[model samples]
Target: MKQARPLPQYLVQRFQGWRATTFGENRSWYRRLAEGGQHPRAMVIACCDSRVHVTSIFGADTGEFFIHRNIANLVPPYMPDGQQHGTSAAVEYAVNALKVAHLVVVGHTNCGGVAGCHAMCSGHAPELEEKTSFVGRWMDILRPGYERVKDLPAENQIGELERQAVLISLENLMTFPFVRANVEAGNLSLHGVVHDIAEGTLKEFDPVSEGFSLVG
Candidate 1:
């Protein structure tokens, strides 16, 4: 039998330090959380980018927010097919089961997945078009978003496309019956946000203005 590789020494040391410090100081809180189960009020869908820190940005505690991260923070339109759908399933659980009050889709600048989608759609990355390319297949969900911003100059398209990811996800989230029902019933709200990674700034979508506004 093949043995599983052990975790890296650095990670082990970090975990030990956390266990001794942060975990130790909050032991009772952790215990209470374990016993009570999670009751997060908000559900955040964010990019897999390491720079996008959802909990830190909101100053959220351990059990305050239910977070789900995926490539480009894209939420595909609801498809009730028998096949597996990780993002949709999470949304269903968050809205139907957890009853989160708010659903936020957070996109970020300089997203590699968005850039790859831009490349693939523009015919610059022919390799991604192959059926065997998982990234390409997954990114195809963002094709419509790309089309919406294709007219922009090459230099500006990426940033616009990044914001489009959040917008698209927000739009797609409504396609889920559970999400729409909760939202229309005033039990849930949907939000779209874009983070400028390098500048450490955020822009929130304004449904009234139909555009994103800087958060002061």
Candidate 2:
């Protein structure tokens, strides 16, 4: 018979290995960061995908971005009512407490959530209703995105779907009063980014250029 290994043992092994490598080289940097508290220049709202790591994708350091992760990286519309809004709470802390200079909504290609939305909107994947629950409400933020790219050609689906979602999220970010106030004051900037994990590339939405471009 095979023996069962405890989950805690595997976790300890991973932690110890990480400490030996990452902590060994930059002990002082991490130590200072822990002491100084989180003072990131930006706050990145990204998906909680194992493959889509925010810091790794941005080539950022430990304290560079105050990251908040959720399914599909959805940003709920700001509401005064007492709802269980974890994503909104994180955004509030990032904008109100951390006062980050930039707020970036990072979407990606081949996103299961976005793909599911495409299915739900198109009436092709009715199983979404029976199998998934939260995605219905969470993906409401991307309704405008669906409307924007609903009629695009099949070849352009990959590019347009992800692009439209990022644009919509960027617009939604402004709907938050704190985001709007800070942006109007010229103290805060908003950005939309899409990570193409398959191609190992990133596309950034350039406001000045008014289009998505490859990021070096």
Candidate 3:
């Protein structure tokens, strides 16, 4: 297979122009963000996909959200021992260090990572273990969520899978001592959200309805 070429120089040059636009137009805000520590109202766990930026999706300004992005936006259960756990560490810092008031686990429809769950649960791709692909390991986090909702209709499985995975992550978020303490004390709230990339609409999980509904 031919190697993919790098982004063209014109696009790279345009990147600087975009940054300059933000920097030049928002100089005072950038300076404040640099000098004063971030005090975001919410912490968002989002996907690493280039198209699914949480800030832009939420129409947020600088320093509005403490954000962490990983494959499929999955968060693992807490572990006490030190590990190179990028996702967990981000949660710890956002909740404990930054003390954000809200934590949102944002899943999206038609996600490549969630779709990969069907293959993972079926164990049809053994080659994944050898390649050590990032998607393979990250998909493992969804196994529990998959098992919980596997009996649902094939068409509905992906939606339930994504939603339940966010719920699992929200539950896992509480495993961290700080998050648990803060949430139990009513100082912090947890939310599960799903974004439809094609439509540019957001749906948040409603405990009363026991399903996802439009956020607005």
The candidate maximizing lDDT is 1
lDDT (tens digit, per residue) of candidate 1 on 1-216: 478888999999999999999999999999999999999999999999999998888889889999999999999999999989999989999988899999999999899999999999999999999999988999999999999999998798998999899988998988998888888999999999998888888899998998999988
Worst 10 residues of 2 by lDDT: 124-133
| 76-151: candidate 3 lDDT, tens digit per residue | 9888776699898888898888989999999987787887876678666665444577777778788888898788
TM-score of each: 0.97, 0.88, 0.89
Better of 2 and 3 by lDDT: 3
RMSD of 1: 1.0
Worst 10 residues of 1 by lDDT: 1-10
Please provide, for model 2 over 107-163, each residue's C-alpha lDDT reduced to its tens digit, 9 standing for 90 to 100: 887888888878877777676655456777677677777887878886776467767
Deviating ranges (above 4 Å) for candidate 2 = 1-8, 130-132
lDDT of 2: 0.83
Deviating ranges (above 4 Å) for candidate 3: 1-8, 129-131
Q: By summed lDDT, which 10 consecutive residues of candidate 3 come out lowest?
A: 122-131
